[model samples]
Target: MSAFAERKEMIMTKKTAYEFAYITFAMFIISCSIYFFLIPSGIVVGSISGLSMVLNQVINLPISLITFILNIGLLVIGFIFIGKEFGAKTVYTSILLPVFLAIFEKICPLSESLTHNSVYDLVSYTLIIAFGQAMLFNVNASSGGLDIVGKIISKYTHLEIGKALTVCGMITAATSIFVYDISTMIVSLIGTYANGQAVDYFVGGFNKRKRICILSEHYEEIMKYIMEDMNRGVTIYSAVGGFDKTPRIEVVTIMTTSEYKKLLNYLHQSDYKAFVTVSTVNEVIGTWNINKNSRKSKQKEVSVQ
Candidate 1:
């Protein structure tokens, strides 16, 4: 079997209670954000929120009710376009979201405007809710509205996620404009933009992209961190320093960003003269030696010997 297939198999088989907790927490966050912020503002942040706002206006239905009804069709579409894996994960998220929204709405009843200045108030709430919404999605949970719809578009239309989300947001926003207040439309647009940005920002820390760029006299020590401590594969690049003509050893490894930060700090502090540069990598397609057999098998063990 190909190495990629082995990694994929490992990911599929691995299960833990923490994953479930994150998923459920993500669902709850999205639901509460929708109920307290978007619904109260009559604004939509994306495809799902937009649809709920529009449907609620047209039929005078509760936003959560509309979300629940719409998700049924979107879920089917995801199954067709995105496959069973995404669809299966979305199933629990999709159901739990609307349930949380409905329950929160009934219990809290935060719909009454705290201030007459709904525009500013709307934006404030939208930004606040985006925080929670972003956190949930950062952990790979769905928002259960046109959210699944956006994913479906990405799967079937062969579009990138941002483009798919933008397209979905536009359609839903335009549809909503006819029925919602003008201020709501404006807030909806702001919410959509904010939602997208929030996802990109929070997902970085939450998803964990580990990268290392070492600038040090102690090339061996950096390599030790990469091999012994991190136990990840590394690529070494030889570079000449701009001012000194001295050759520098640059080691690059992919791990979680937190891990990367920790390693970077360690290298910098251990060698005060060390200059390190780091980047937030978008993706890292590799494995750490954490499996039962590999737990004690250091990369240094494999490479140094």
Candidate 2:
């Protein structure tokens, strides 16, 4: 192989290793929340784990075993319908979660609730599971089961993952009514909502970008710094100040949070009086760093690799 190819392969290998390590730790956190808090308290917060909890009550089977079986079935459906990428991304966490749960169960079995307070326990586990799932989702990985179904919903229906997961959770939470009392079902619904909120809260910051508009007397210097030093694109617009009605140049650019911080620091040092307006950008299209054709060709090359 060429030197470039070898280097690229090494980078990809390192990335994959890091991803698995992170996913493993996230799954372990989820498993601990399940075995320690949720299981003992009978709080079903909607997921394969929640469904397994309900089923285990009726069939008297191990929750870990039930989760394993359900995840396997979901994996098959995901592979056939959702495409190879989704299946491949989910395979590790889907399989590992049940293994972790089983190991935790064997090593440190829970006979009763840890705190003996159902409300606090449910909230604690909700936060823990939500954070773990957020970590997985941030990395474009999932804990599998209904998450695969959520992805299917998002892909075909164009629903957001959080909304799709909420829909799935509602269905699973409804089933909890049969296994537990109405009060338990209410708690499950609240926990489900909290879970979605926590995931959104944590995952939102990771992909969020800033859209910055700078009206500066030294627009040229700012633009030069952005284009040459920061290596980011900028769009200049001719504008008139509403108050003074004077024609001025408005520099606009979109950048990640880190880049925004750097640009803000530069503005403070160089042009402290620059009129800046920053807003959140949910998404960006096209290439930020390279030409369109080059980006398309690079994508194709990466796919081939």
Candidate 3:
């Protein structure tokens, strides 16, 4: 085979390997968080696990048993309500999550609650759950039950999924108030909100930073403010000013929205002559190539849409 063809094959192999590795790692992290940190403490922020906890209370069954049973129903519903691919992933997470939890429950137990527990710990648990969940979503996977529901919602609704999850979470939390501790429900609500927000914030954090590519003669002042004052990264690209054949130095500086707004006010006050083009960047993949392609409706939304 040609060298070029061989190189392309190698690249594809690496890419596929990386994708699987990431998904596998994400699943491991999620399982650990659920079994280790959340489950033993009855920290039901929602999902199969939360429902499992509630049912476990009445039935006097282990959460693992409840989760395992519910996951079967969810997986079937997901196959029909969502799709096959989702069902396939649910098969693993659903089964494995319970297995891991059961093993952890039998082996490792936390009798005492988290010391100094408050709204902050509530928020902290919710945030941690959100982070694991967001990772699963990023890789187009699920952790059974409501995650399947969330995916189904995203697949069908064509709306922002984080918002959909937030809605579902609130309902679950509200319902739990009748079943579990009111304080736990309130804390779950807080965690649910934080989880939804944290997922979006975490996913959008990198892309939130934008580089305003400005075409101006007053590059010095903007450069100084962006670099010296803001301590942001700036790059100067060579270009010819449109409507004038004059060669000019275009200033490109990267900063967040608030920072950009501050810089904008500064530029307006310092040099209104500057012509800046602000583009909403998606993500910076490498040293360059801001990946605007990363953000999209989740699988559940696509099904409905």
Query: Which candidate gets the maximum TM-score versus the true structure?
Result: 2
Q: Give per-residue CA lDDT, model 1, range 2-112, as digits (tens).
A: 554565466545543555677787677666655655555544555765677667777998986787678778878777776776677678776776678778767877747
**Model 2 C-alpha lDDT per residue in residues 1-305, reported as the tens digit of each score:** 85445656676677778888998999999888888888888777888877997899899999979988998899988888877766887998877877998898888888889989988888889888878877887676788988888878877897767777888998898889888899888888888878777766766766579999999999999999997677788999999978989999999999989989999999999999999999997656577734333444455577778
Give lDDT per model, in order: 0.64, 0.83, 0.69
Candidate 3 regions exceeding 4 Å error are 1-13, 53-66, 80-84, 99-109, 114-120, 206-278, 282-305
Candidate 3 lDDT, tens digit per residue, 61-82? 9887887787778788989987
Estimate the overall C-alpha local distance difference test score of candidate 1.
Answer: 0.64
What ranges in model 1 sit over 4 Å off? 1-14, 44-46, 49-69, 105-107, 114-117, 154-163, 181-184, 204-210, 240-248, 268-270, 288-305
Worst 10 residues of 1 by lDDT: 292-301
Best by lDDT: 2
lDDT of candidate 3 at residue 3, scale 0 to 100: 46
Deviation from native of the Cα of residue 20 in model 1, angstroms: 1.7
Off by over 4 Å in 2: 1-7, 52-66, 106-111, 243-245, 285-305
TM-score of model number 2: 0.82
Report how far residue 304 has shifted in candidate 3, in Å.
44
